[model samples]
Target: SYKPNIAFYEAHGLKGWQALEKTIAYLNEKCPDHFTIADAKRGDIGNTSSRYAKAFFEELNFDSITVAPYMGKDSIEPFLEYENKHTILLALTSNVGAFDYQTKMIGDQMLYQKVIDISKEWKNSRNLMYVIGATKAEYLADVRKIIPDSFLLVPGVGAQGGSLEKVCEFGMNDQVGLLVNSSRGILYASNGRDFAEAAAKKARELHVQMKKILINY
Candidate 1:
């Protein structure tokens, strides 16, 4: 799976948009079998959400998109309407700022748990997934309890100091429903002439570790 966070591209202005388009096109041409995620973290009102859904799933042709669930079901339902596409909701993110609201206790359960529990009742939730940070890998056990079979997109593996072994131990389901992402760790592996080679080497290391973890599962 390849997840290109839109922010990285958008930061470069027009060239960023061009690069993003070309990247997606290249992925489609070279590896159509691989899942592509647009890490946009978008969530808006019904009308605007519909357009965002069309832009990513229809126009951009990404297999899935990361969406913020703060606006409630009305904002997210538009994305869920797409049968073949996936809507990955932000739950426990891999950033320091997540401590602000996501972890606050709402009675016996944390806020993120409430988001997961309530989202489970949303229509067409079978196509739903959650973003749980690898930085908080220990919480995976608790997250699995809310939605045992749902897929989880875990970022913060490399540059963010997340442990893949810890994530796999508690986050992996019978279906192996976890996508551990390493962006800067792989992208910026080298700034010299051998950047691509260095990136490949970094990716291979993660792949090897993942394979080892999968063996135990």
Candidate 2:
């Protein structure tokens, strides 16, 4: 599966959008079996939310999209409405700032816990997945207790110094529930023309490592 951060292309305006469209087109044509994720943390009011959902889920033909949960169900249900698609909510992010809000206790539970617990009751909640930062491997146990069956899209595994071993240990479910994204660690493996080769090598190393862990587990 491929996850592209829209900001890198959106920063270029129309030309960027065209490029992104072309990229998605090529991926869909050549790699139909692979899942495609538009890593746009989009959420807004009703009409605006519907537009964003249409833009990614319909126009761009992405299989899933990441979204912010701050706006609650109204901003999210529009995305969830699409069948055979996924809406990935921000639960516990993989960043330093996560401790600032996500971990802070709102009552007996942390704020992130409340976000996850509440989201399960929303319309079409079965379409929901979550973004849990791999850096927060320690918190995976608590998160799994809430959504044990839902998939988790985990970032920060490579360049951000997150341990794959630790993440799998606490985050793995019966479904092998994880979609780990590593951007710079693979994409920037080299600056030369051999970059694709280098990137593939890095990805393969991680793949082999993951397979070993799963086999042992």
Each candidate's number of clashing pairs is 0, 0
Model 1: CA > 4 A from native: none
Clashing pairs in 2: none
lDDT of 1 by residue, 107-154 (tens): 999999999999999999999999999999999999999999999999
lDDT of 2 by residue, 102-179 (tens): 898998999999999999999999999999999989999999999999999999988998989999999999999998
lDDT agreement of model 2 with the native: 0.95
Model 1 collision count: 0
Error of 1 at 206 (Å): 0.6
Q: Which pairs clash (backbone N, Cα, C closer than 3 Å) in model 1? A: none
TM-score of each: 0.97, 0.98
- lDDT against the true structure, per candidate, is 0.96, 0.95
